[model samples]
Target: MKTRLVTASVLLAALGVTAAPPPVSAASLPPVSASSPPAPAGEHGWVTSTLRHMSLEQKVGQLFATYVYGADATAPSAADRAANRAAFGVETPAEVIERYHLGGVCYFSWSHNLNDPGQIATLSNGLQRAALDDGSKGRVPLLISTDQEQGVVLRMPAPAAQFPGAMALGAARSAGAARTAARVTGRELAAVGIRQPYAPIADVNVDPANPVIGVRSFGADPALVAGLTAAQVLGFQDDAGVTAVAKHFPGHGDTGTDSHTNLPVIDHTREEWDRVDAPPFRRAIAAGVESIMTAHIVVPALDPSGDPATLSPRILTGVLRGELGFRGVVVTDALNMAAVRQRYGDERVPVLALKAGADQLLMPPDLRLARDAVLRAVADGELTERRVDESVRRILTMKYRQGLARAPFVDVDEAVRTVGAPAHLAAVTRVTDATLTAVRNDAGLLPLPRADRSVLVTGWDTAAFAPVATVAASFTARGARTTARPATLPSDQAIADTAAAAAAHDLTVVLVNKAWDTEVGDPRASQQRLVAALLATGRPVVVVAVRDPYDIAHLPGVDTYLATYSYTRAAMDTLVRALHGELSPRGRLPVTIPTADGTGVLHPYGHGLTW
Candidate 1:
């Protein structure tokens, strides 16, 4: 009966219709309401009184969320400070706060080395103190945010308890699991004095070649993405009391180009857009997502001029605000991306975004120029003061609801305990284990023949696998001899050597961490070559995808295949347990795995095998 239902669901998903519902009904999850407007007294009185006395410059500043960086808790060295200034065009968080009177700050892994939870807490507390002390007169708390989207885009280093991103949750196929993952993420971030989490990417990844939003999105199914995203918003806002922002609005899941590098145009017609791209956003709004981040893509059907959504009133005001009935704040994607920078320079992006109905200007190329541009526009009547106030009202109302007005400071010690807590780690382990989907097991290669077989392990990682080397160690503990051939798509000569070594092994396990393009290296062709070489050895091989499940579509005629969805330690443990027959492979494939030629989908969205 279960097999028949699973087959039926897979077929339905393959046809792009809603599949059979999971065991846990999405309707059981509580809906998150839109943030209530600020009250007249007490906690809300501060925001109302503060907004009445703000100058035009201050009001404009409230709309900008600047970038911040810290090498370590000891404060950046002179050289590091200079490097930061060169990179972000801002001196420091304190300096940016003082000069711009910015509304918020976003920390990045590259800029802020968030390796230690204690250090992150210290940095956040100090910055919050600086924000409180700055004579902005209003004493409004800074909305500290980071890209803690888990999975592929983990910002914090060690103690953040990163989960297996969106698709993993989709593969788990439980709205309750989605809520738990997000709740854990929000709870840890809230403990660190970071009240705003710019996450729960609501885009439904319909395109397999979507370079930017592959694993970041929930999956290819619109209804599935809708349910998971709504649950995510609740986890962050309703459960954790953190301001959750549902992002890349309208949808970024079907594009082939990366918005960070260039503008990607979505050419879907009105009916097609309604069918594929718009459902998740509607669901997110229904769940009362506090904010929606605008995409950097151009949709011609919506805006005939071909302007990016970030600068189009037709899309933002006419479509998102008017049609969707979303009263929450609309934040722009980073202005530093070429889509905005190449077209309208840093000086004009914020002004245009404001006119286009964006409430927040996030990570503008130049903070000073962006803020000044908005102020000048208001003065010259290009933008009205009422328009600025509308955004300010929404921003201040959100902050108050997020608990910034009442009690903003967090105890550093408490923050350390909250992030990466044992319970949180345990929850991550459970979810990843449930998400270990084995799509191909034609050769019955799993539950290995013996504990003492010689094995070869290689794919994407450093020698140790960092926090956990459990995959190799698991086999070793069972008395099996294991050898690692870890390489970053080595030269032709090096590939030959690795292949020769694999040929000597009794069994081979190849890991493929292919997803979005990495800045440091290009291992595309080399990894494919390495896999081909290993398969040529005529030895039984097990291919485990540690990053993207789509890696299987490229390897034809392979006997065994598995997907872990991410490289987290919990995911690794899940892999080891499944390989040893300790855990059953029950996770369904979330996204459709396209054929190597990108012409067709080999494994549809809901296909998975269980022993």
Candidate 2:
């Protein structure tokens, strides 16, 4: 039954019509003309003219930015693993442009070939041209957006440059470092005709139990989160000339549940929100952010009625528009997520969101249903024609501001050359070096012996140990026997394996990637148990955390704790350098770790160590 429903949905999506429409056919609607004269300056000339000429149906279609997964048609006999390209033919790009008159598209990594940079570039150019060519007004460029938040949440791998997660940036404690990272990220995205990056997550990491936003957020401090978010926005917009969207507003930092699977309600009071949660968003807006993506979480204090902020006029219009005074575009988190879809069917979401003051409805399940619903509402005077114009104006204003209307194509070679170049790599190195912290070092466990001292390493993903291999190679060059083995047993077994490995070694260096609810397959408990077992061997245990610093409190038995905050190659090298006494551990704990077991950890945001 589920398979049948899914097949129907896929078919309906392919046809671009999911529901029955009113008697007046949308097909009969007039096209927004290319020859339409522009309106006065500062008043969004194209939007005004386009709105005036657009039928009720066309006006409604402008408000939706729908989702297209993989592609439409399959290639002939291509055994390619690039599902996006294989499933969707090259002509599929042109089809989306002509059929839905789509305002924008969210591209997944699987949709384009990441390994072939040239092919990706070609595909991007074709998409842009298709969007403009099908439109009545040739000037309005389509909004191309992506969720490339770096680290584990990265969309494009290999050829596209990947940076450490937000926790690492917070640990670095330098706004300049964050900005440089964002600038490089933006440059890579902009190279492929992707103008908007849904990034620099401003969510302050308040809940360690939060299933989705652990390392994704900067830290738990409002002030530090605000500063880092602003720097990142500036880097993407001012420095790199790409649109930066500060997301999950009012804030997804405090929630314990994941919105992808369920509706997570933030029960904080209005006072608490104003004091802590709202600052980073306010700061980002002040920094001239191009867009703000609404969170799916419900805050009853903000709105007594149980409407999620994504579809709440009280939150979107009253707070964000009226109080905070954000004049830029406001996008909704993917409406297809369970948080929105489970409550309201896909058809009702467009009307509710538009009435709630959202400028764009992102990733709606059925674009045609949403488009038709909005059209019917406008025609019946439920959603005013002026309201449609207002949203269209903001969308166009953003496009113009992004210089997308003027120069659609970027220099692909220049973008590839600039992405993760020498200067960017150096910036990453400096930040990692500055942020490597030695939280506790009893009896001087660090600065291990260069000669005649065997080292037993365990924990962390072995895949991330490629750089460690290089380090081991260098040790081999220095005539030191360094044997690293993965403990295949359970935590206790792993400990036994480590003890066996360390029987002939002087020190046991356990590299632990702390498991948190936010990530998949976090081995926090296993790591803790392994650390305990390794300590039982009477060997000095130096534990290095490559993710969060919260694990320090979990594994207290280990005398020395090193927080690198990320497992990037550069970060790992920096960690190794600190261990060898080549550089001092200068980083401080950016977020606090609780001293007692279950003491309720409090990370007041701006903590970082200085050499």
True-structure lDDT of candidate 2: 0.67
* Collision pairs in model 2: 221-605, 588-609
| Every candidate's lDDT | 0.77, 0.67
Task: Put down candidate 2 lDDT per residue, 1-611, tens digits, no spaces.
Answer: 00011111121121110111012111111111122133345435655655566655544555666544423212212333232233333235555555666678777755543434444454556556666665464334577778878755666554555677677777777787788778777777777667788898989776655667877888767777888898888888887778899988889977767898888888778987886689888988988898999999899989977888898999999999999999999999998888887678787887888888899889776666777788878778888888888888888788777766556655556556655567666766776677687776767766765776666555665563354454454445545677665543246666677667776777666676643321335445666667777787787777877777766766756678777766667677787777777888776555556433334443323343333
Worst 10 residues of 1 by lDDT: 1-10
Q: What is the TM-score of each candidate against the true structure?
A: 0.91, 0.83
Candidate 1: segments with Cα more than 4 A from true spot: 1-44, 71-74, 84-91, 462-470, 515-523
- Among these predicted structures, which one has the highest TM-score? 1
How many residue pairs in model 2 have overlapping backbones? Answer: 2
Error of 2 at 198 (Å): 1.0
In model 1, the Cα lDDT at residue 460 comes to: 66
